[model samples]
Target: MAGRFDGQVAIVTGGARGLGLAIARRLAAEGAAVVIWDLDLTGFDADKTSFRPASAVKVDVTVPEAVTAAMDDVRSSFGRIDVMVNNAGITGPVAPVEQYRLEDWLRVLALDLTAVFLCCRACIPHMKAQGYGRIVNVASIGGKEPVPGICAYGAAKAGVIGFTKSIARELAGSGVLANCIAPAMVETALLGQMTPRFVEESRNKIPLGRFITAEEVAAAAAFAASPECSFATGFTFDVSGGRATY
Candidate 1:
């Protein structure tokens, strides 16, 4: 289990902090040279960041051009991209669907959902070229069990699940494998986007009676990105703390 990603390169979007950061740290600990993509660099100081053999890149995952250029830079600097962890996402303001602003809705989808598509589009070619790769997308239990207030977040995540499944089928014949982790509520910075009532309600829904930890989600992510995850593609590994019904 140790050094499962030895001598490999991993790209983790939104990895400056929170769950993405935890996942990046786990990957690096497993010997993958991790490239963390984030809009903010303040928290990514390699010396201060909780990881080794890792670098931080400022790239907007929501932008195709930025993603492509960043990937090129990673390829040029690191030589190859063996693992891709599309962990970038957001939960827009918690509001009723009708009350949600159009602009906010678009923004949520742009980053939470569309960004995954763009990152995957940019990374898939590189992975295909390598003839071997692992893709671990970070989805949410909200995608399956939609909450009432956060329509944008839930819808975007549902799209991610669908996209992951489709791409998994497309790449199954190839060397690259794709899968996603659908986690229940995790205590992370993104929680700021949700209302207090919503958060409390969500916690109550978890059969385990508690929120998931970022490290727990990261552990699942590490496995999805490992070489041993060969048999399952397009699979949704649940980190729902008993919240997931299916």
Candidate 2:
């Protein structure tokens, strides 16, 4: 039996670990030839070894040349890009706005917001030419309901949600769809940046009483990137454990 993504070529940014890894694994399992883009390749071999259709390339998504070159390499290797998951991000400087370092705020915005813009800019032409594509951006619940002590992270993610929506509108006639997943407090390495007190407070606010799981985030991403997702571009899927009731 053929999988949902059989013969598709998928690119997952920040796929070396965390939620990105889960998204990459899911896409590969569904039969897409998965190309991972990340700065750190540590533990990346595990995915390559476990999934026959998976590979990784070193990329700094914040760098336009790097992102373009990496996408070119992916095109050269796989011939076409059918799916693009913008899953790379960082939670920078978990501190009050008054105490936040300017550099850290800038870094978070670069990775979490600007990188999404760059990835979309680079991949859109290929997708438009191919007449098909799916773009899934990983946003955050904090984006919808800004969290204190992580204002920079929240602002960047909020920008991502808006960016995806705007692009979806622009690409509506191009056969390329763009959507995003806004998830709450997923138990990934990003959590390391938060204090225990912050984590507990976040969990308490969630009606479900817990942080989201990486696999859960991946599942939503997969749906957004699948062909069945037709008719639903520029949408934000909330996996915030009831925290994002809107």
Candidate 3:
């Protein structure tokens, strides 16, 4: 039997590691030609047997020109763009709002929020022309609720939710669907940087009492990108291990 995403083409930003890598792997396993876009090119193995040799492209999503060039390259190589996962993001500094530096805050916003806009702006036109597209953006539980010590990261993710909703409405008539996923304290390398106390606190707060695996998030992403995900644009899927009741 053929995979669900057979013949589809997908681009996953920050696909080198963490949640992005898991999503890329899942999409590829489902028979989509996958392009792993990231800044760090070291040891980034794109499983060629699963997808179309898994193109590994170095891209900084915050830079519009770079994003355009990367997308163009994907288009040229893949022949069509069917799905995009905006998963590149950074948690800058852990500080109170009063102690947050302007530069640090700006950097977080640029990467976490602005880059999503840039990618969507560059890719939506092609998707519109084809009359089919699926966009899955990675936000966080902090986007919906309060998360202290990471104000900039939280705010940027919240912006992603709003931006995705607006664009989802605009493109609903054109056969392109946009959605965002909000996960809380998933098991990624980035989580290692969190203070032990914070980690423990987060785990305790989760009703499941455990950190969500990257594969869990990947499953949600795959569903959102699937053709069966019709009539669900502008929605937010929660993968917060029951931490988010909304």
Candidate 4:
């Protein structure tokens, strides 16, 4: 049987590790050509050899020029980009809005929100030309519900949700589709930064009584990027492990 992404070319930002890495591995395993754009290029060297059509490039998503250059490099190498996953993000210091530092807040916003805009801007034209594309953005459950002590991260992710919907509407007639995924407390390296108390508290809040796995989030991402996703643009898929109810 053929793979779901056979012959497809995909760009996965922040794919060096965590949820992004999981998504990249899935896509590549399914026969898609995968280009991983990440600031940390370590350990990914092995990925190039293991994945048939895979390459890793170091990139800071906040820089528009760098993002554009990476996109161009992927286009030159792969001929065309069939999918783009905006998964680069940062969780700034957890604090109340009043205590949040401006610089930190801006940094989080730049990476979590502005970077998505930059990647989408660079990739939409290519998708439009091909008359087919999939854009899967990694938002957070915090985007929909209020999360204390992480205002900046929540706000940025919320913006991603709104931006994705708008773009999906704009490209409604086009073959491209845009969607967002909101995962709650996934087990990743990033979660290590949270305090033990916070982690335990979060676990308690989840009806499942456990954290979601990165692979679960990757499954949702694959679905969004698959050809079957044609009818669902601007939609938000929740991977909160029952933590979020709507």
In terms of lDDT, the poorest run of 10 residues in model 4 is: 44-53
lDDT (tens digit, per residue) of candidate 1 on 1-246: 678989999999989889998999999898899998998877665567647546777898888899999998999999999999998888889888789999999998999889999988988998999899999989999998889988999999999899999999999878899999999999998778778888899899998999999999999999999988889999999999988857
lDDT of 3 by residue, 1-246 (tens): 239789999999999888898898889888898898898868565454233336888899999999999998888888899999999998877778999999999999999999999999999999999999999999999899858888999999999999999999999789999999999888998877678777788788889989899999999999999998998999999999898988
lDDT tens digits by residue: candidate 4, 125-166 = 999999999999999988988578889999999999999999
Point out where model 2 deviates above 4 Å.
47-49
Task: Report the CA-based lDDT of candidate 3 relative to the real structure.
Answer: 0.90
RMSD of each: 1.1, 1.5, 1.8, 1.7
Error of 1 at 112 (Å): 0.9
lDDT of each: 0.90, 0.90, 0.90, 0.89
For model 4, the local distance difference test gives 0.89
Instruction: State the lDDT at 59 in candidate 4.
Output: 95
Model 2: per-residue Cα lDDT at residue 40: 94
Model 4 bad stretches (over 4 Å): 45-53
- Model 2 C-alpha lDDT per residue in residues 53-78, reported as the tens digit of each score: 35778899999999999888888878
State the TM-score for model 1: 0.97
RMSD, candidate 2, Å: 1.5
Q: Lowest-lDDT window of 10 residues in candidate 1?
A: 44-53
The TM-score obtained by model 4 is 0.95
lDDT value, residue 94 of candidate 4:
76
Comparing candidate 1 with candidate 4, which one achieves the higher TM-score? 1
Superposed Cα deviation of residue 9, candidate 1 (Å): 0.4
